[model samples]
Target chain A: MFQQAKLHWTQSLHLELFQNSTKWHTLYEESYMDTSRPATQTATQAPPQAQLDIDKLVDEHYDYLFGYALRYFRSRDQVEDLVQETFLAVIEAVKSFEGNSSPRTWMIGILRNKIIDRLRLKCREAEGESIGFEQDLLSHLFDSVEHWISNVGPRVWGSCPEGALKQKQFFSTLEACLGKLPEKMRQIFLLRELDGYERDEICKTLKLSSSNVGVILHRSRLALQHCLQVNWFEEKKARGPQ
Target chain B: MISCQRATELISKRMEEPLSLKEELSLKLHLFICEFCEKFAQQVHLVRSAIKNGSTEPDDSDTHASAEAKERLKDKLKLRS
Candidate 1:
């Protein structure tokens, strides 16, 4: 119930991607249109044909950027604002773009940095697991020397349920399992696994040390696996000698 | 020999970053002797990969961008008309 609401609460809202009117405009015009730049001067540059189409760029990549930003922000306004900021940034920086990285890579890198800046300003709850969650919950899972307590060790999941990936129940179970995680750990897991963020990138974005990222990731993985065991996996027949 | 405890952390860490050679060797040895830990490592990898591209809850709303947001970005990009 609570989990279901959280899942739906994060729903992505989008209408059919019908191409809105495509206006043929140069970067000089569009870039200046948004700002106070005098509109008449066309800067000397490679032909517009050679330069990437600003309209095409936004049209093609908006959804990717939107979805990526959506991962970090639940607010529709926030997501669009970040995306708008990113598009503006991309155009403004396009002249300086070295063309070494692919356009998508460059744009995403910009978005990532923008998100971190937002994170810093927003001062969202401190990242990584809370000390209380650590001292109370995690300490109970391990001993003083960092060994799993008996009966708390990992268990056999036996055979994974067939066709589970095709089933909605599996994702619901996954969503519920994810909801049980500490906020920071859940974000770390989603960023690292689902969003495909590299460890150092995640560390920088969340403002955590690499090793701290490792710890949070390790614990998140453990909790997720354990959660799956109890909630979904262990229900199946076991093949191991009990 | 790494304890099952530390060995498990290394299991998850290896997913995000490369393990030191010594750490890697210890993990390989621990996983070799401990079937449960070995299975645990594999299962973790399975879940990560599934979440990456294979797993999908198509019914979820946020997976796709809102059309209004798209229009707004186009407008902000100065897609005049």
Candidate 2:
């Protein structure tokens, strides 16, 4: 009789948690609906005259799209698949293009949504393994007493360049470092940094605790700063005269 | 004095939300004396700015799509069109 009561309480607890999560999912989806609904609704029967020149579009934008997709997917085939999906989405949604933005910008907007949808699915699938990645990285950087190790501590990076992001070499090196991050860490980092999602919003969207998001973001920044210092700054010094 | 690890964590945390007065004061005190942590704080700001500016779009000079992938996509679109 006692076991039965305990089981009933646990079941009700799960139900409450499930209901709260569903509430989060609905709230997340509602935000997407505002931006994504219109183009998708009209996508089914795009006017024939609205047909985009697929060949031209591919020739012009394929590189940019491919490079962008590589940020999320490592394998060339997987990246190709994402780019293909983006173009297909563009073809379907072209009629709804309001000419308010350039074609490149519009396609980027579509591809961004597609990437987010894929990430949302991935987040659910990898829920268990989310936060513990690169715990060793933190320890390796610091010590048992929560102090940075002597040999592994940060170096002075000098001044940041005036137009650092505009430089292709620096940006590519940054992308490579980002690619080196653990998958879940990279996801949360990008969602916060690149996509500009708020902390609470990220907690809801990825179904992580607020503290977990904070830890992941903190570790990711540490790792990334180290990577940039090594790959970009030190390497530049090595190649140049003092 | 807080350890550098704790100081760095607070430094990153401050980016997400305003730190408590105690946290802010401790972190500020730590950064003031520790050259490495000070450099680290600057790098964090630099990296955050770089990510914000760079990653949203593909750079023109970055890697481009292969011909085969483009051809394959074009062929697939042909069937749909």
lDDT for residue A65 in candidate 2, whole number 0-100: 72
Q: What stretches of model 1 exceed 4 Å from their correct place?
A: A1-59, A94-106, A120-129, A135-180, A189-207, A231-242, B1-3, B16-29, B51-59, B62-64, B79-81
Query: Model 2 clash pairs?
Result: none
Positional deviation of A57 in candidate 1, in angstroms? 5.0
Residue-level lDDT of model 1, residues B1-81, one tens digit each, is: 888778888898788778999999999999999876886797787677557644332346655777876776666666432
Scored on chain A only, each candidate's TM-score is 0.54, 0.70
lDDT of 1 by residue, A124-211 (tens): 5664335566566567667887766756666655455335566565566776677677656666677677646688977776677888
Q: In candidate 2, what are the lDDT values of residues A80-104, reduced to their tens digit? A: 8788888887666554443323455
| Candidate 2 CAPRI category | medium
Q: Which ten residues in a row have the lowest lDDT in candidate 1 chain A?
A: A9-18
Best by DockQ: 2
If scored against the real structure, what TM-score would every candidate get? 0.62, 0.76
